[model samples]
Target: MSKLIIGRYIPGDGPVYRMDPRGKLLATFIFIAIVFLANNWQTYAIACGFCLLAVIATKLPLKTFLQGIRPLVWLILFTALLQLVFTTGGHVYWHWGIFSITSFGLVNSIFIFLRFLMVILISTVLTLTTMPLEIAAGMESLLKPLKYLHVPVEQIALVMAIALRFVPTLMDQTVKIMNAQRTRGVDFNEGGLIQRAKAFVPIIVPLFIESLNVALDLSIAMEARGYQDDKPRSRYRSLHWSHYDLYNLGFFVLLTVLLIIFREH
Candidate 1:
């Protein structure tokens, strides 16, 4: 759990880290589209290769990237198993009532699993490289046009930023609470499904209380600071697009075009 990398930002001087947050967000969106465009093994392989190049460019430790996906292993496996057991069309190698594994099912399962992994990796790279504030600012900039539609863009951005900023904090708090519970004779790992869930009740209740307290405190702080959505705010650091951003965006755009052209429908 300590090794979980989701929603945690690591400060770095890599090219990816220096690119504009908006560019990163756009690239991630495009990459997701590209992933879904993949159909056959060749396209999936290309997608995997693109993700590999991205992971390498981030300059983060391979172990760190792997840790980000570790928690999702079971989810990926479950999805793959569902695809394998349900999908039917190709040659069937085994059959047991409604559970039959066909060649098409196997292929689809493999591709789906790879797709899940690649998507996770790409998203992890974005969070690891960008700070919460940058994310909020980027989102706000991207959604500025929505303000004309009477959308509360700033408030929405603030809410998103705060939620992301608290992820690591909450994870750390959960870990601390779990340890405290363990000291009080709670065994989280040594139990059946229902038993383990019951064990977590003690942990969850206290965590909820703590979260409430934190939220209350934050609300008080914001009130003390006179935070208002209707007021104009000044930024400490403004975002500017550099040549690096252009290069990064261009590379992804070119990659997307190439993927589209070669992707098997």
Candidate 2:
């Protein structure tokens, strides 16, 4: 699995790590939308260059991003294959009974692959650089206007933060449970798909119980600490808008403009 660490955060000192999480979050979303603006090699190059630049800004090892992407390789490839098979037109290189490898399909598949890759890249950059608490705070602040519309922005943010924080914890617990079962002679990979799924039955039942107990314990602890959803709260670490955030905004806006200018008509 190469350790799926999508929601895992790495402690580091760098420009990306220092930038406001709110900006990073906003940029991640905006980038996802803007990535589709590229339709040709020229446009794709520009968009991909921006992604590479943003990645380089993180100052984290390339291996970290590679590990995060490795687990998704098959999914991305499957999507690309769908695009390659279903898309039609342009010069045909090879043709079969129901599938044809046309130049258009090939290019479109590559574009689809790159778009998916860039989106995951930006999201990984956000989660990797920002802490869970900071992400929650950023989300809450960004959604603050929703309070006027009666949305529980704080609770939503809190849930998201908790979910992110628990991803690694749950993964570790799953691993531990699997190892314990292995010690008891559970053969997970020794049989076919059905057999492998059956092997997971023991892991799933105990893991579910453990998860419930953990959640109950957390709720109890929060109750003891007097945490309330409706109460007004102040952060021990408040978020502040900075020149760096403005710079990030400008950088992405410039990229957006470039995409618009260069994209196909």
Candidate 3:
């Protein structure tokens, strides 16, 4: 759980760490969108190169990103397996009992695996580079126009920020709870399908209680601070759009164009 990168932020002085979160957010979204535009080796190769560049730009240890991806390795493999077995098209190599591998399926499975991996890597970069508060601020800045429609944009952004900030805390709690359960003679991995599901009950029950307590504590802290969103609030730190941010967005745009051009017609 600690290995998961959903909300983990590593402070650094690298170029990527210096860009505006809004640009990072938009670039991440665009990268994810353009990933689907890739359909062949050339496009996927470009996509892979783009991912490599992003990871290198983070200027963090390679192991850090690899650890973030470790937990999802099986999921990516399983998805690839399904695509390889069930998808049918092109030259069929083998077919029996709904299990078959065709040329199309083989190609598709590779693409699917690469696609999943690329998305995960890019998302990990975003989380590692940007803090939850920055993410919320960026989102709120972008979403400010929604307030014209009577939407509570600030509250929405605050909720998202809180969720992201709490993810690592929750995961750490889950790990501790799992360890406590293990001490109580519960084995999460040493069980059958039903038994494994039952094993998680001990972990989940306390984790839920812990989550509630955390929430209550947060509420109290906010209340003590006299938290209010009815009006504009001053930011302790302000986000400024920079040329580096524009550069970040532009690189993704170039990657998008490359994918569109190289992808299968």
Could you list the CA RMSD of all candidates, in the order they appear?
3.2, 2.5, 3.4
Candidate 3 lDDT over 181-258, as tens digits, reads 889888788868999999988888998998899999999999789897796777786899898898899899899899
Candidate 1 lDDT over residue span 68-123, tens digit each: 98899999999999999999989999999999999999999999999999989989
lDDT score of residue 206 within candidate 3: 93
Clash pairs (backbone) in predicted model 2: none
* TM-score, cand. 3: 0.81
- State the lDDT at 102 in candidate 2: 92
lDDT by residue (tens digit), candidate 2, 83-182: 9987899999988888988999999999999999999888998999998889888889989999999998888987887877787798899999999999
Clashes of 1: 0
* Residues forming the 10-long window of minimal summed lDDT in candidate 2: 1-10
Q: What local distance difference test score does each model get? A: 0.89, 0.89, 0.90
Question: What lDDT score is found at residue 145 in candidate 1?
Answer: 99
Give residue 234's error in model 2 in angstroms. Answer: 1.6
In angstroms, give how far residue 34 of model 1 lies from its true place.
2.1
Task: Pick the TM-score winner.
Answer: 2
